[model samples]
Structure formats: C-alpha cells, structure tokens
Target chain A: MSQRSAGPELLRLIELMARLPGFGPRSARRAVLFLLKRKDQMLLPLADALRDAGEKIDRCEICGNFDTVQPCAVCQADGRDDGVICVVEDVPDLWALERGGSFRGRYHVLGGVLSAIDGIGPDDLHIGPLVGRVEAGGIREVILALNATVDGQTTAHYVADMLEGTGVEVTRLAHGVPVGGELDHLDDGTLAAALRSRRDVKR
Target chain B: MSQRSAGPELLRLIELMARLPGFGPRSARRAVLFLLKRKDQMLLPLADALRDAGEKIDRCEICGNFDTVQPCAVCQADGRDDGVICVVEDVPDLWALERGGSFRGRYHVLGGVLSAIDGIGPDDLHIGPLVGRVEAGGIREVILALNATVDGQTTAHYVADMLEGTGVEVTRLAHGVPVGGELDHLDDGTLAAALRSRRDVKR
Candidate 1:
C-alpha cells in the first residue's frame, strides 16, 4: 500500500486493479506482480483484451446486454422465441438464465431495479423500452425474472402494472425452495410460499 | 463460462481476466461487466495503465527490481547504504521489506528460489549478478531477507556458501513469532526458534 516502495506506474496499475469488484489492495498487488511475471503470456494478452473490449463492446440496443454487436448475439439469434420476453435486473442474471438453458425466449435487461434510496426511478431503467417492445408486439408473455428483494419486487410490480392493458400476460419467476436446496436451510417466507404453491404429483 | 452467451470480445476479456491471481470464472465475468459499466472511468484507465506498465517498466540492471528506469529508483537513490545489500526471493518481498522502512540498504532480487521440482537452478535466479556485485567491492554485508520456507532457507544457504570467500559478512532475517502475533496461534517450529533465540529485556 506504500506507493513509494514500487514504481509509480506499477503502483498506478495496482491502484486501478484494486478497483475491480472483488480485488483489494493486497490482492491487487499480487495480481499486478502475477501479471508482471508473465509479461508475454498473460500481461500483454490481458492488456490487449481490455483494450479490445473497450474499443469493440457496446450495450445491445434491443436488450441492453453488452456485446460487440449492436443487437447482441442473443437478439440476433433466429432460434429464440420472439413471442416471449424474459425481463431481468442485469446482464449477470441474463447470463445465469441462459446458462440454465430452460428459457427459449429473448431477454430485456433492466440494468438495475427501482431503488428509491438511490434515487432510481423507472426512467433510470429500461422499463419504457420494454413496454414499447411489448406494445409493438408479437410477445405473448413477459416474465419478470427480477430478484426477490424489495427494490426488485417494486420494479416488477410497476412494470406489470404498466403492461397490463398491452394484452401480454405478465408473469414472474416462482418463489420456492431452489432446486437442490435443503429445506432446513430455507427461510420461513420461502418455505411458506413453496408450501402454498405446492404442485400435484402425476403418476 | 458459456462462451456463446456474451460475444467473443467480451468472452475473451473474461477469459483473460480469469487468469488474474484471485479471479475465478464467475468473478472474472463480474469484473469484466464492472469494467464495461465504467468504460470511461475505470476500463480505459486500467487498459492504459497495463499498456504503460508493459511498455515503460523494465527490470533494474543492477538490482533486478522492476521500474521505469534502467537502474530502478532504489538503486539510483543516493541516501541508501550502498555498503549493504538485502537479498530477496522476489520483487514482492523486496517491496515488503522496503515497506517496513527499517532496511536502509539496497536490494538484490533473486527472481525465484531454487526449486528441484520446478527445475529452477542457480542459473535461473540472479545469484551470479549478486556475487559479481560483491566481487566488484565496497559491499560490507549481505542480508538474506528471504522467507522462512524450506526453499527459501535452502536458497539462503546456497547464497551464503557462494559468497563465502568474497570477504562480505552474511546474515539472515531473525526467526521468531511475529510482533503482535499470539503464541497460541504460532507454529511449534517458530516457537522453538523464538525460545532458542530469546533476547533479554532491558527492564
């Protein structure tokens, strides 16, 4: 953390690396040293990657997902169901859902939920654009795959209300014990919701 | 982890980011998204920093410490004790010792310790340059401020032996329980060394 110990450029590299989501000063220094040690193999390639990403990547105009393409590969893909749209809070959630591979529909990224404390309103998100996509039309359903947090729920409810008269059926991800999750570790609210929404088993 | 979900450039960025010391696949994706979000502020600066460090930084010819200068800032500093050289296993250790602010001497970076399993020998390190420095004269002492690991101790012994007939006094960092460390949490070897090398209190 003492800047004078290492050179200014090296110190600056560590400082910027520390700004990464999970990196602290110590881990940043370690990462910088790691990069320094593997200059040709790792450092140069990483730098090139960063620069290339910076220059090439942009938010998808249709879904708000970041990609090199304007509409994004997801949006550009012809195999997905255009009749259904899955609304998510951020790109990570979109990626997670895609990884699950169950949903065949396209996605609409909200960028973030409506947080009054942080002064985020509907305008701050991609809500208007979502409504426009639904209004313009072939979408039969819009699934709100937002987090179950207060801000997320509020945003979902607001979006559902806005799209009420648009003829599209607004739905949400189910509230239940996650698959492979233990009942003992489940919270009371989730357990109660799961019990209330229990499905009948078919032979 | 799904390469096709995010575009090629973004995927490549995440792949390179995953190679960083502490980042895994998930965290690398998060870090990449974080950079994407703060394109002008964080991403560009980090890219610039990496490129600058890659282009400008080089190992000091005399000490092997990485810096923008050929001799490095430490080797060029006029106030430090030129008569003493603190030998370390790597640049991180050199930085750590410098951060302590107790060592007024210059340093010699060994790059790495001799590891039989890794096939690292004496030639792989900067031991030859160190001996050359001592042989050139004016150096009164050489402190082996290496780690307490087996390889570190082995390297220290090897270095001591190499500098045996050169008329330079050789020493090592003291082996003891670290300051502010609890005795109960200390290892038996450290405790034994501390006990055997106990210093008398003035009071």
Candidate 2:
C-alpha cells in the first residue's frame, strides 16, 4: 500500500482542507477533529460529497455555469423573460441578483471579459451564443451587469457593438463602486448608483 | 413527490446549516449562495456528503465515539499504550488531547459522568469496561482526566471506588480551572494547575 494509504484518511483530508480560505493549519485540524467527533454528522457525508462532485461536475452549455443539469435551471425556467437577458461576468453575480428577488429574466454568463493582458478575447467567452440569443428575435433589453473594471466595460462595449444592427437595447451597469466589488458587498448607496445611473451603450 | 423534495433543496440545506455553531442564518444563506454559485467546486460534493453520512453514521461499539468503522482508528491502534489510559468526558476533549501530541496512551471515553440532579449514573457511562480494562492485565495507571465540575468529581470518586481491589494506580487531573471551563479555553497557568494537582484516587 502507498504511504497515502498508511495513515488515517482524515489527516490527509485536513491537510488538503487547510489550504482553503479562512482555514489555517490549526483551524483545519480543529475542523477535522470536529468532523471526526461528529463523524456521523459531518465527516462521512463530506467525503461522499467530494467523491460525487469529482465524478459528476459539468459546465452548462448555454451559460458556462457549473451544474449537473444541462442548460441549468435558470436557463430553463419558464417565468424568466428570455427577451431581457442579464449579462454577468460569472455565476456568483447572477446568484446575487437572484437573491434580491427583483429581476425575473434570463442570464448570459460571459465566463470572463476581454482582458488583453490575460489574452482573453470575444472568442474566449460565450459572446457568440449571447449574440445568437439576442438576434433570435423578440429580445428587447440586454442588461450589462458586469463588474466596473476596465475589462468589464471593454467587454460590454464589444458586445454592444456586435449587437448594434440587431435593434436590441444595450445598457451597462454604472460605475463609482470599486472594481471587483461584488453586488453582495455593495451598500444601498453604491447599489443605487449602479442601478439608477445605468447608461445606454455608446458603441 | 414528497413535500421534502418539492421546495428548494439549497434553501433546506442552508436552514440546516444555519444551526451550526459560529454561523447564523445570514451566513448560512450566504454560504449556500456561494456554494450554488460555485456548484462544481462546493455544492455537489457537499450534497453527496450529506447523503452518504446520513446513511452510514453509527456510534463506535467499544468507545462510544461516532465513526463509520466498527473500532475507530484511535481505539484500534496497537502502538498506543494500554497501560496508561486517559479518560475524558467528550470526543472534543479527546481530540484536544490528541492535538497536544504528548500522550502516548489509549483513551477511555466516558460519554458523560454521574450527575444526581440530571440522573446520570455510573451505568450511564462506560465505567464498567474501563475498570475491566484496567484490572485485566498490562494496565499500570488510569488517568482521571475528567472535568472539574461537581458531577465530574462525583463520577471520578465512583469509578475509583469500583477499582479499589484492582491495585492499578488511579489518578485525577489537578483542579484549578472552574466548572464548565474547557481545556481548549484555558491558559498555561490553569492547564498546568489542573495537571499538577492531579491526586491519587481516593476510593
């Protein structure tokens, strides 16, 4: 048997877990110990989860979000207005919007924006599919809820330019909040500024 | 479908998670949202773990610790000294001792101790097997590392009485920490006091 199989599996799990955010080696050890104590309640289930996800995770074909189901529930929901798609850089922002319970629209996940330094371009994201979704017809508004970063604005403008002749309304989320500031972290002032000052696409 | 399967599974998971120590409902909701956003990295594994552990958890037959295995690793380790057993009230205490890396002996998990007001008795704990283990052979000393609570002392005395004719050296952890004070929370002075005042079993 390998040295990996020699000692307790829980110890190895703790070592891996120690690398996670907010968990130092001491905290990881404590968490592992807690899981061991409540093995029935925590440890075994956690192990099963790790195994299951390792076997089954896949990205949604339409939005590039991780899900077991194809297209994912959000893409398939009947109540969501497909004609008014909210475009975001990642799925976390989509979920943040969903928690607010205000918007009842479909979403287009860009995966990430155009970053010249990172070598990311329009082809790297789901931009082609987003344009197709818009041009397919009946679509009115495309909300650019991307972050306020330069990359995010650049990506927004690039998408707007692509969709210009298609007669769809394109708008970008307002700036003033710091780049990479998640919607969840925004106070009402910043959230309101981002919401109320949302501007029409210039390109 | 059952009502259990009808509502949002993620919501239910968050509700259950909110009750955990150090987390409130808001944090639990945020955690669930975070998991959902990173479904591939966090959610699917967590879900599988919850299901698997829910199915396989059981208390250990010998030491009453929770584990999927019959005899837990600590209980089954042949390298541990059976001659010097450290007794503790809960698995958390056992875990603390394990982290300290000083003790080379095996442990006896009491599960709890004698509390007249709460109706806990010697029979309620694993005291019988403890005495049997001490008296059988090769065992030289029994460490009474129970809490400093009134009931803890009461249970310690009761166990000492049961081992009077056994001739095994029975000793208690010294008393300096107050009742309800956990070893995890104690300073060096208090922990050392508890260590130094350890007395011979007064049967």
Candidate 3:
C-alpha cells in the first residue's frame, strides 16, 4: 500500500475493504483479487448489495435495531411482549441475542457503553432514550443483557440507577457457566461466578 | 445467518461479504454493522469503489497483471529491460516482486502453476504466449521466480523445457536462507540448501 503499483481504482477498493473488522492490508489485497476474478458473480452483486443496504437500512425508532422500517421488524412484529425490554450495548449484541431465537421481549440498544477513557458518557449513548422508553409506562422489567466488560457493567449499573422508582424491576444477565462450556476452557472469573451462582437441581 | 433478523438488504450484503476470503458469518455481520453505522463515510465509498474497480480494472493482455490498461503499467512502463523477463506464477507474485522495487526487467505472469490435483496444466496457463514471446526474439534471460513448491518447480521445469532451443537462458531463484533470517528459526531444508550453496566471504 505504501508503494502502490496496482490501478488506483483497485488500490482504493483494497483500502476500503481493509477498514473492516478482521481484514488487514494483505488480506484486503487477496480479497480484492478474488473479487476481481469473479467480477459479475461476486463483485457486482456485492457492490449493489452494499449500496442498497446503505440506502435502505436505518435504525428502528423504538429499539435502535437496523431495518428497512422505522420501528424495525422486531418492534412491528405481533406477539412479542412490549412490557419487557432486553437492553444491549450495540447493534451486533441485539443481532446476537436474536440469533438465539428465544427472546420474545422487545429490545433497547444503547448504541455503546460508558467509557470514560473514550470520553463516552450517558449523553453519548442512547441511555436517555432508554429511560424515556421506560418512563413511557407499561414496561415491567429491564434486563441488562450487556457484556461483562468494565465499561459494559458501568453502563448497565448506570441504566439501572436511572430506571429506579418506576415500579419496574431492573436486572442484569446472571453470571454462570455457559450451557456447553467446559470448566477447563473457562477463565477464573467465569469459574468463580459459576461456583458462586450455583443453582439447586429441581428433579 | 440461519435465523435472519437484520434487514434483507443488509443480510444480502453480509452474505456476499462472507464469501470473501478471511471473512466468516460472524465477522461479516460485525462488518455490516460497522458499515451501517457509517453509511455516508465508509459504506457508500466502498460500494462505489467496488463497482468502479470491477468496471475499470482488467487483466494486462501481455502480462496478466490486473490494471486499468490492457498492457498494464509495468508492461507499458518505459526504460524497463525487454531482454530479461521475470516469469512469475500469479499476479500476487508479480506484485510481490514489484514491491521489492528492484526487478528492473519485464515480467511474464503465468497465471498459475501446473497442478494435477487442481486440474491445472500448462495449457491452462499463459505458457503458450510466453513461448511465443521468447520465440519472437529480443528476450535474453527468463528467470523462474516461482514459489519454492512442488508444483512451482514442476512448472519451472516444463517452462524451461519449452524455452529450450529458443536461444534464451532459463534461470531460477536461489534456494537458500533468506537475508536477515536466523539460522535457529530456519527449516532444515532451507538450512541444508544454504549450506549446500554457501559462498566464500569476500575479505
């Protein structure tokens, strides 16, 4: 990239592709070459898809989930409980919970966590919108399905503090061993949490 | 991806992106989310770049390198030695050699090596054109700068055989320890090669 030899157009494509989460300069070059090889099959469709997605996908007005609609498909869908809300830190977290295909309650995406180092406070996130959603009435519970990182926990605690005295129970995701997780593979913190939060077998 | 919840257009974008090398479903989803967050800045420009690169970039007619021009920049560049050709296995290899900024001679991209398992043969590559180039005259040395692999060596032999009696000298890259390579970290084969091809130190 420092010594550019390829066409400017191709190099530009590599530069942008390298901005993705896992791609580096070397991998981006390989990906570009691969895409160029399958111009009609892969490159054209991908270009069209990227543009179309960018044009259509917008955040849901209610939950901040990305969709082609204002309120999102999750918010618009019937039978999902509006009384209970599962709060997440980012869009990827919301999508991750959706992948489980079990959560039937509505969702509230906070956009990001509270990071003092990053100068991200409550105002930087959608915490105020969340509190407003809670204050709108009829919400019974707010499950803080946030990550177990320091920033994530701080954000969850702050959201919980803001949502108090509203006659609604605020909760955080339980610390325990994952369903198929091995004790050997788990870290000391997870193991300790698992041991501390042990539940009795109800046979 | 199996339990799709994101917008159809966004999901389509992820699906196409996942097909790219080094991208899996999870990373693709994360990338799509990242792109959606910066619609105007990253996503749109990437989409435009993809389309533009695909439309404009083409393989060099003479060297098989990807570029906007038919003969490519390297092939058309003035003052490059036409008497010496560095034969490479693919575009990336050609690019790698060019990155050194030392190979002043012209290049001949073979497109690929002769692989029996992959059903790749000499006819599948640009060997015919290479032979034609040598037979047409003006070329002196044909450096086999192919990778140090079985298929590469086999292809080098085949090319060398083909170039015989064409009045052009066929050479290969030296097999030895790389410059600045530590002997302890080097493989046995490379160490053996380095020892076998050792040169007297100039006083």
Which candidate tops DockQ?
3
Better of 1 and 2 by lDDT: 1
DockQ of 2: 0.11
Stretches of candidate 3 exceeding 4 Å from the true structure: A1-4, B1-4
Q: Using alpha carbons, what is the TM-score of model 3?
A: 0.96
What is each predicted model's overall lDDT from 0 to 1? 0.91, 0.69, 0.89
Return the lDDT, model 2, position A45.
51
Clashing residue pairs found in predicted model 1? none
Residue lDDT tens for model 3, A88-177? 999888888888888889999999999999999888889888889889998999999999999999998998999988878999999988
Q: Which has the higher TM-score value, candidate number 1 or candidate number 2? A: 1
- lDDT, candidate 2, B6-86, per-residue tens: 124444454554544444666655554455556666565455544444445455666665455667656776778868888
Q: Rank the candidates by DockQ, best first.
A: 3, 1, 2
Which of the CAPRI classes, incorrect, acceptable, medium or high, describes model 3? medium
List the TM values for chain B, per candidate.
Answer: 0.96, 0.70, 0.95
Docking class of 1: medium
Each candidate's number of clashing pairs is 0, 4, 0
Tell me each candidate's TM-score.
Answer: 0.93, 0.61, 0.96
Local distance difference test, candidate 2: 0.69
lDDT of 1 by residue, A1-203 (tens): 35555678998999999999999988998899899888899888888989999999999999998888878889988889999999999999999998888888899999999998999998999999999999998999999999999999999999999999999999999999898999999999999999998998882
User: Global CA lDDT of candidate 3, please?
Assistant: 0.89
